[model samples]
Target: MTVNIPQLRAFLAVVEAGGFSAAAADLGMSQSAVSHAVASLERELAAPLLVRSAPVRPTALGERVLPYARTALTAVRSLEEVAADAAGAMTGTVRLASTPTVSQGLVPQLLRHWREELPRITVRGFEGDSAEVAQWLENGTADAAILIDPPPGPGVQLALDGYRALLPRDHPLAGEAAVDIRDLADDAFLISPNGCEARVREIHRLAGVPFAPAHRVRDLATLISMVQAGIGVTVLSEVSRPLVPCDLVLLPVEPRTSRRLVLSGPRARRWHPAVRALAESAAGRLAAVS
Candidate 1:
């Protein structure tokens, strides 16, 4: 029962691409070859990895093995990068994960800076909610991630984004310089459950108000529209200001609370050379600014 790198790569590609054909195209192999590699890997493991559905998904066993496969591939990629490192020119892909809020807020500028600093290194962005982004980093699905409210480590602090109230333009609190959470207690509360729920709950608790939300909305655009239509108000990070429609108003919370965003390599594995380079570049830039 010996598994090899190619098989692992094929398995991962199939899972990430959601089908054999797309995996084949991505790996520059024939569909049959991709299918064969996956089949052989499954046979070696003596278990089925994919459900073979319209959009293929991992089995329970495959889910357990997915992280190991990703970590192994990261090691292989690092080995292949040694030569590029020695040549004084680093060239490879850095799979970077970010939550939806950070993706909308900070990722664009980070990408631009990376493009200027490391033109040869391709930085691919993977967007998910906070939990999914954390899972991606833990499972090695991403070489690096920008984590929210992360614990202190080798990671560089990117930003401290404060929570704010998003209200309709004509709302009574909209005219105030800052709004107390208790002030909006009687209004319909539409919660953005992506990553802000815990902080919003804390806000309510601190304000001595109930945290019951009238609606739980996932999409930022839909949340904004709901607020605009006067259906409800919501709480979001200050970083979300750019996404708010001009017709809506964002007010600072009376008691400021912030989430820390950090950029770091995957916690479960050694950093890829390209990821290390990117982190170093970011740290240098931050130090210069400070």
Candidate 2:
């Protein structure tokens, strides 16, 4: 039985788009044509591949088959490019997503170095919290991601870093060598909005205090801004401290609450060479900051 490239492409498109009509639009075909192709694929495989409900979800068989199809497609595309490169070629784009801290601090340095070393490889970065970064990797919107406190599962590479407290310049704790979480329990707390509240809760738990947040903001910049304004104190990764405004002081948090950073993609080590290169370069820059 011969595998049909068109059928496979159609199935993968449907899975990516989540509906036949959307997939058809993406593939430049009619909805009927997309439906026929998926049906043909299911017939050839002797199993139902898609669960055709409102959103048109993939079945377990489809989920298992989808990754292989994507891998095969990526390989085929790379082979075609290599063949074309027999004459001359050096350019490609690597799409990456990262948390705001990595995006603001580390990525710029890595991009500068990457441009000097691999002029042909362009690094395009998207910024979000950890959850958004993970979602981008899972949905194929990103070729790779630098995520903080990534949810546990397969297809992730863990990188660890320590946290520090951000305090206003005039705040009394700024003069301390290292302030423990318990030292600040009575103080008003500034926290990163919803997605990162867990980190604050962990700090409170470690300090044996209730996790009460007086204010919450979505990113480090905002949290630090609030700190500088004397709204409240918050803890964040050391990597993020540099990006905070100059008026704020970064102090080591005692007993050390650590942040786990993870680099993740669908293929892990099998990632595109450009992606791997960028990941390594970014890791080096982050290590230096740590």
Candidate 3:
């Protein structure tokens, strides 16, 4: 039996908006119509979706089916984009997911390159943690994503990222070619709670030291501010070197740890024309990046 797109969309809207009435508002349909559509979808799939609570919640089966439904819809949308591309009428947005590391500095530069190269196309970006980024790709929330050391997938290698030490500009160790982890044992260290934190801590553990941060921050800007003010030192990806304030210096770590950055999409393969174009645009701008 062929699945109805409207019913599938109704189910998704309800799940995302958290209630039948909200989904109805989002879809510009009556609440009863939205409910009926969702019921039809559940019947077609032979699975129950929403719990019918005040704030709608997905059942276990609904959770399992949602991703597939999203992928199906994305594939349909991409097919339409493909037709537009073939006709030289492509002017659509590609949704991209990335981390703060690249989103803060590199992504904007890439976007500018995209605008100059492909003026007709639009690129929409979303920032999240690595896991969340992957989730966006899997759930079809993003057309493509910049992933760091992700699992096996068909993707383009963008960069190999190395971890570097961030220190105050005038710190004694800043002039060194590479800073040994032990050198900052006594310093008040500022660390982020996510992204690079675990990796940095793992390096410290390997060196027989604990990564004890005197301060915990989440935003990359705040992290840099703390380091710039001589509050502490921390480790970050080399890609973030460009973002270091003039008051701060980025030095290589003695035992370098690096991650591979790639552009991955659904199933690690991109199908949408916009996603492919965006990837090519980014690949063309590597030299401009610090």
Candidate 4:
């Protein structure tokens, strides 16, 4: 089978974007072109890859072949980077994923550092909840990701920010230097399910406090707004302090708890050269500051 890079790219884009039109927009090609590429790929392979439904899902064969496709594309990108690196000017786009808080708090600085270190590499940002960010990295949608509490291997530790108790200005515990989770048990507890819920729950569990949150908010902004309006109190990372309104207070949990933020390339495939460069840049920055 003579499967070309364009056909592989078109297939992956279609799967990632969910439809030909969206894939075309992402790939900067016409819809017809994307369709022709995939069709040609199918013809060459002599099997249907996609089911072509409302959102366009992959068939069983497509599912099995997708990982190999990603591997092939990653390898090709690495080859291109090899040539660029030889000329001393690396150029490519690396899609980086992160949670909402990390995106807001750390991504700007990280991007700036990367730009200064690897000027030719364009790093695109993808923000999602923890699960979605992890999914993007696994599914080849992202070349690298800032993973929270990632497994210990093949990644750089970016930052370690502790989770803090969020309280309203007028709340009694708000003035304390460090508030115990048990101290706020009487208040209507709020939590965001975005990425930090498990950590929050673990904090509560360790403190012997109930883990039931009165409000399970999805958006970080809305959760902070709720706390500001005296709807309830919550716990969030210290990194999220900037997102909290001034009226809401963030106090260190009495027994401080922190989460590790790591930056790493895809777990399933070879690291794109730009991703490797980005990780090295971040590590060097951290080492310099330390």
lDDT of 3 at 197: 84
lDDT of 4 by residue, 58-83 (tens): 99999997998988986787687678
**TM value for model 3:** 0.74
Instruction: Name every residue pair that clashes in candidate 2.
Output: none
TM-scores, each model vs. reference? 0.86, 0.65, 0.74, 0.85
When 2 and 4 are scored with TM-score, the better candidate is 4
lDDT of 1 by residue, 41-118 (tens): 999999999999989999999999898998788778777777667776667878899988788888888899999999
Q: Show how many residue pairs clash in every candidate, following the order shown.
A: 0, 0, 0, 0
Backbone clash pairs for candidate 1 read none
- Backbone clashes in model 4, listed as residue pairs: none
Clashing pairs in 3: none
Candidate 3, residue 114: Cα displacement in angstroms equals: 1.1
User: Per-residue error at 4 for model 3, in Å?
Assistant: 9.6
Comparing 3 and 4 on lDDT, the stronger one: 4
Error of 3 at 249 (Å): 1.0
lDDT of 3 by residue, 1-290 (tens): 55888888898879877899877876679999998988988888787888989889999999997888887777788687769788866467777889989787567777788899888887777789999898878777777888988878677777888889999978999899999888889889888887698779877887887778899998888988888877888999888977887878889886668888888767844457777666766666664564
Q: Cα deviation in Å at residue 222, candidate 3?
A: 1.9
Identify the superior model by lDDT, candidate 1 or candidate 2: 1
Give lDDT tens digits, candidate 2, residues 92-178: 667678877777666676678778867888777777777777776765656678777666743334345677888887888888988
